[model samples]
Target chain A: MPARKSAQPAKPAPDSTRRSEKSRRAIYEAALALVVEVGYPKTTIEGIAARAGVGKQTIYRWWSSKADVLMEAFLDLGEQSLREAGPVPYAFPDSGDLAADVKAVLRATVDQLRDPRFEAPSRALAAEGVVNEHLGRELVAKLMQPSLDLYIGRLRAAQDAGQVRPEIDPRIALEFFISPLAQRWLQHTGPISYEYTDTLVDYALHGLAPR
Target chain B: MPARKSAQPAKPAPDSTRRSEKSRRAIYEAALALVVEVGYPKTTIEGIAARAGVGKQTIYRWWSSKADVLMEAFLDLGEQSLREAGPVPYAFPDSGDLAADVKAVLRATVDQLRDPRFEAPSRALAAEGVVNEHLGRELVAKLMQPSLDLYIGRLRAAQDAGQVRPEIDPRIALEFFISPLAQRWLQHTGPISYEYTDTLVDYALHGLAPR
Candidate 1:
């Protein structure tokens, strides 16, 4: 779907398929790098092409705009992250201990956040999304929703097992697990650590009032 | 401090004090209008000056940059909101009921978020802050700090009365009340309303766990 937006049908000729794959990857990496260095507004296909050492025609032949390239680039980064997170990382662990499983996932999230490759571009994209409604919704739909769905699935499982109160809406409940960390990173309000995420998980699972 | 940033020391020459006040108000309105319309990047001192129908020198005589002008305008907006909230609005109601007090303040926040005068410009500035770290921090200090301190104070009172866990960090605990709502607005994830905020209050206080 994103490639459809990119207008790149991956017309991998039966011959130049290897070359096409190389060019596509080079474009994604270059787009991510440029966005981080110069920001989204200042970045362009020309800039990405020059940086990637590919011709502008090659870029135009595939992608429609800088936004499309960047979106797909970020998606690629996320896919890479999932691959790095070990096999089946997207599948939330159901150790039948909801709190521990959530904590484990959040801790992994903490590690990914600390990873420098993701930090700068993410900040740039998130910052732009804050101002740009179209881009913001696109990010929520393309980048954020899949991960959110995974959380929803895990929470539903917890509800079925009676680990969570049946009355709670999993979508909103998931915010406690993720939004705090997201806000801290976006706002620079606090340091992120395993400790902070673990605390959020605990506070979220147990009543903050006297138990 | 903000007035200092606005560079408008109250020295209002005995003769032009009223005129000065009028000009300052016009400048604030113009700065806010321009930012909402053109966004922070395109909003210029020159544009604000043109829009306000004042000479460039008039703006130069007061604020230093577009950021300073916008900051003062936002501060003015916050003041107007407080005024509308009635006298002593800054005081979070204690009434020996933490949940009720927090809910009251959050509901007021919901109204403020929905206010047309606040929403567009606020979103514009908030979006910029996400990408611009310096502006982001300044916003937290100038716009967010006083309200945050109020939350801290009220939570401290709750802790002293043993209403909340003595070990709970109010700073972190308070996010449960606001960050989810903030994310919902910033990310376009869901609808915001008194009913939704009330649910957040209930969830954050009682928590997702069975009591």
Candidate 2:
């Protein structure tokens, strides 16, 4: 839900809006830090409110559950990372050269993965998601699906350009670029680097078998 | 360590050996069950001993820590699954058709991932491993490395047989076959099926680009 767009009307006054934004940012920070310090189960809405220096009713007024708050907090974190990386558009690049464009995107992903602020909380939530199927699906739907859609869109363009095979399923094909890095990070299977991701893109685009 | 080999001498008497084996099996079962029920941190040697109806000293005598015991128990579970699958050699199959051999192996893996006995405890351990780097590396080194090695061996053989590109690094190339399936299972990203795995093999070997 990071790039969600909706029409807004009946906005609050400027002073109240500023205050609300401040409180919201505080809540996001507190929720992320709390999840990292103590895990998902122990991170309560009340605890987040306390850490954020707000009332419990304030959090309840917004998110219905701890999971809701945490998911939003994660989305906000991704946006923050993107902002820090500069004012880049929120679409996968399509430079006509499929390999170069994908490599550029994956290199950016490598930087994001190595970001310490992103690493701890991401792992905490991801660990919980592994065992909690409900939250796992929610994470995929809300957090992952958008990024996956970008990959799909770019691959479709590649197919149109006669770069990728028209018959290739973009959904499964995207996994070849991302899943290896994910498995290595999640399972400690191996080290991750720009070179590793570049290699993944290469292997994925070109067959492992001889051409 | 399912296919671990070691020289054995100075064996115990048959009766004592039988009793030891019975007790060891019980400990493994108890450990696996406890982890699934209450999770990794709550599981302890005392609890496993009580559940297994053995002295704490018995668990201590064989294993030094809960992680140690759990790793061995998982290895045992894997061996049990293999035994039930019929007597097959521990090496990766080499029929010269890399795609068929890999697909066959991944199909068996899909079955194992879906097995009732393997599912719960494996999830519990995997969930913990995501957050705990120490335990995560141990899990990879002891439980997963063997299977990865098998894939590496098969890929290397494919290279030798000129079925694969000589320059492709088998270590990373093998991830194309397994990591997609792993991500689906671990993250609930997609449904896993024989058809899905077969497609992965086909895509991996044939490349995503048109020939």
- Candidate 1 lDDT for residue B141: 87
Query: Candidate 1 on A1-211: residue-level lDDT in tens?
Result: 3345345445667667777778889999999988888778789999999988899888877778888888889888878988986786557788999999999999988988888888888888887787777888888997889889999999999899888899999999999999889888787666899999999988888867877
Candidate 1 per-residue lDDT, tens place, B1-211, comes to 3345344555668668777777889899999999888888899989998988899888877777888889889988888888876786568899999989989899999888889899889988887787788888888887888888999999899989988888889999988988898888888877898888888888888788787
Question: Candidate 2: where is the Cα deviation over 4 Å?
Answer: A1-9, B1-11
* Candidate 2 lDDT by residue in tens digits, B1-211: 2112233236769987787788889999999999999999899999999999999987877788899999999988988889888999777999989999999999999999999999999999999999999999999998999999999999988899999999999999999999999999999999999999999998998888888
Chain A vs. true chain A, TM-score per model, equals 0.90, 0.94
Q: Pick the candidate with the highest lDDT.
A: 2
**Cα error of candidate 2 at position B187, Å:** 0.4
Candidate 2 per-residue lDDT over residues A76-176, each given as its tens digit: 99999999989899999877899999999999988988999999999999999989999999999999999999999999999998989988999999999
Scanning candidate 1 chain B in windows of ten residues, the lowest lDDT window is B1-10
